[model samples]
Target chain A: MAGEIKCNNCGLDNKPGAILCEVCSEPLEVTVGASVPIIASSSAAHTPASAVGIIGRACGLVVGGNVIDREFELPKDDFGFTIGRTDLDQGIIPDVDLTKFAEKVKIGQDVGYTVSRKQAIIIRRMGRLYLRAIGGAKTMIKPQNTDWKELLKDQEEEILVGSRFRFGGSEGYVIFEVV
Target chain B: MQVELTLGQRYLPITDEAEVIFLLRLLRDSQKQSADLALDLRKILDRSGSMDEPADGGLTRIQALKAAVNESLSLLRQGKDRLCIVVFDDTMKVILDPTIVGDINAIKKLIDGVRTGGSTNLSNPLRYTLEDVKPMDGSLPKIIIFTDGNVNAPSAAAEERACLELARQANRLGIPFAVFGTGIDYNEKFLKNMAEVAGHGSYFEHVKQVGAMRLRLEDEMENLKSVQDLDVRIGITAEPVVEILEAFKYVPQQLALPVSGKIVKDEFPGLDVRGQAYLIKTKVHAGKAVGDFKIATIALSWQGVAGAGVKSMNVVVNFTADEKLISPVDKTVRNTVLNTEGTKATLSGQYNRAQTLFTTSGNTGMAKKVETLAKSDEDAKRTLRTVTVTEANKGIIGKKGAK
Candidate 1:
């Protein structure tokens, strides 16, 4: 059952371990199922809505509100995040009241509110992962897409039924799947 | 596509997380409907009261409120309308604070932790709420108060005074208030009256039907309108022919002035200010197209300067059409009558009624009170006033453009 995964952007078929499409240089994320069957199962059931809460830490190099350098760090309980002048300059200026942003992303660190445009960038990290689990062990899972509602809702039944669970950490790992 | 908008407006904040979350949720929902809401509950709520009440729901007014509040919280959550509950009996406490109802266990825990007992001091609780709801700068602040009765301790009057001060602060800060009375013994008149004064609505409910109360709360919350740079003021023209006397009131008619304050609205106000252009809407009179009418002058004194400790900016508007000597109402007689009638009715507590006298004349009350329980409070009598002016010659006469 050797199958090839093709890149939509460059129309390139990348190898199992390929980081980028060999033909067009597009980013290619590959997962090996033999070693981690859970990864394949999780991907099949992934939803976009869960991205909001699953996002434990995000490093966005914004140049004008549009993310230029977007990275989701692994969930860590103590890594500090900053939305400095660069973050503000990149596009969306942070307000003193971080309610809107906080709703989209759970804020666990002291956000840099005074960071001016261009001079500051937003480095959002977390102090602890606030996720629910079946036996108290944090799960290591990631969805193919980042839509918050669909992710959370599709997992709602799994979450409320059986030993199924979902969890996140300060390390940016939002894991929740039925094993 | 993500569009970024910059809001330079300033406001106070509530350091308490739950309170902030609760208020913010309410604010976000309201923002979807109206674009000009500017009241910050954080700053006002943070001023007085305990942030946490011991988790216990016993036989007392607090317990009754606990149950009612719990039901309301559920309704808000199920409806996807965010809500927060802050309970203050003898002390201020964040019972449920601000928690989204997606998690069943959290909702159960929040509802189950309701505590009872303590003196009912309304001022501190309200102050704390106002302080805790600092709107995300430029966002209008709105608050809903649920209480058993008047201030509980000997400092009742003092608390009322504090409430008056808070109302003034809310006016300056652009926050509105709504009051709720739970339980039969609760001070319905006082709470309702205060809601009228604070430019918010009021609700009364017994322990049995919190479900009904929840609906009322939802109605008021839904009708809230957001506005920007809304400043209102009153001024006199020629010092009185019939001893013109003095005029006082709450604009948009929901708030009750401290004493003998005339006029009130059971719901929200007009003028949803989401954009920049200041749309000045007022009624004008044409008269017989030939006479002189007396006009009164009014002004909206900007307080942003006061906040910055800078000099205040005052903008003046005349009710008269003719620009005569030293504020004389020597405009067309019919015009003066129409404008003067509006000014009189507004001051006399018939603002909304007067507005309708010309447009529709009959739809007097928007959300009327079903029951009026008596409590012998002089404040209620003083706050009630009626509008008796015709609308044919009505027009808005004030500063058109001043930031």
Candidate 2:
């Protein structure tokens, strides 16, 4: 009953049991009980190890010297994901909650780490991943094998394996690497 | 009617000058015919508890606001112009949909029926207006929002951001949003930020009396009527070494600066009315070796309201630099910069800095500075008149709510 579905209008893949395409929001016509042939055939062609390998790489954040740590597996189907603190009233619930790493911070107070409600975003475009700063606070990125820090604003920079980026100009940073 | 567009400086010697500031002024030979304009005007009136307080001559603030709205409605061309009215407190009620201005009596009656009571929720009504206007085609769109208190529900910061984002969306759709803050209690920064982000809009602060508020509304209505083009965008393509530090439109409206060097181009949006001007401050990092180079090209594209097709114009600034040839000081550009800087300082509650800048620039008198302080920061005004820096600091320490 669970399988990938393709939107005929925009050609975007929808997750298993999705009634509409996530990207285009077009309704899918298939019945809920029916199985998708394309997904079944694709899974049949791949071995279990290859299937595991096909799972997307992950990016994670470490806050307060191991006070809190979490990782999110980047969506293989989507082009990008946003990381920020969540605010339900504003209808902004970022894909990755950076504040989940905070241990004892109050809701509206500066988390001592200074993370913004809407911070940096990671985008995968043109066969490469990029990190961009979209918030008011300062965000800095440091790639592997380089000690220099490059501050990001509304501009985008390439994010590669072993890349490190900090939000809100704090010591806490998130590392992106293949798992 | 003929309109002439000109730049402040066509050539400059860039020696030792890190930043170049200039003005772009638009002038018209004669006023164009206003009979053909088809405009959609939407007004959002605040019905919060504060509006019930008596303002001038025993009339409530809401009553004064209604009178102003009625006067402005009388100015609209009945058959050609469409109007919508929305009143909001913690909740919003759409009193009139986009109706032709022909039914002036009905509109006046509805305006009289707007009563005041609840807390303030500024963002939701704006969102509602956006939704109402988004799908409409072809009429010049404008929204006027009047509020007398801070955004009370859903938190102040969140609502401010939401309003700003709504303004940005409205700007992209060529809809100008003018905001009026009636009293000192309203958040001027929030209202100003909304106006700036809205691009083709103005923010007016009426702190003195209800009659002043009515006059401000009348002036804005006149401005809206005079708009020849609804959306005018100026695009600046600068050299890699050049960076635009700040930009301002009519009456010190600030444009957002580009955040990175990769952004080689930026656009400043405004309404294209006759006698309007735009000022920009840009810095060129022409390190050591510079002889003669073209710095930037400013291009303007606009949608004329009078059935004119999209019009475009371009101006280029070329610079020649040496260790000896320095650029001459331009007074208009200097005064503009000073005005913008003083306004910015006053907004940030640094009254002394604003006073010094305004005094040195000779553009603003001490009385004007005091008036600005009275509207923006009462504490800063008190510091300006009575208290020294040390006394102010001691007062801040002594009182818990001094800020």
TM-score of chain B of each: 0.45, 0.77
Q: Would you list the clashing residue pairs of candidate 2?
A: none
Q: Count the backbone clashes (under 3 Å) in each candidate.
A: 105, 0
Q: Which segments of candidate 1 are over 4 A away from where they belong?
A: A1-179, B1-33, B36-84, B96-108, B131-135, B154-172, B182-210, B225-290, B297-403
Candidate 1 lDDT over B322-376, as tens digits, reads 3231121111211222233333444355544344321221111210100011121
Q: What local lDDT score does residue A62 receive in model 1, on the 0 to 100 scale?
A: 31
The model with the greatest lDDT is 2
lDDT of 2 by residue, B315-373 (tens): 34445443233323433344445545555565566666666554544433332434444
DockQ of each: 0.01, 0.01
Worst 10 residues of 2 chain A by lDDT: A34-43
lDDT of 2 by residue, A28-142 (tens): 4433111111111101232332322123367655444231333666533212556677643222345577775423334375343456655766654223456767564567776
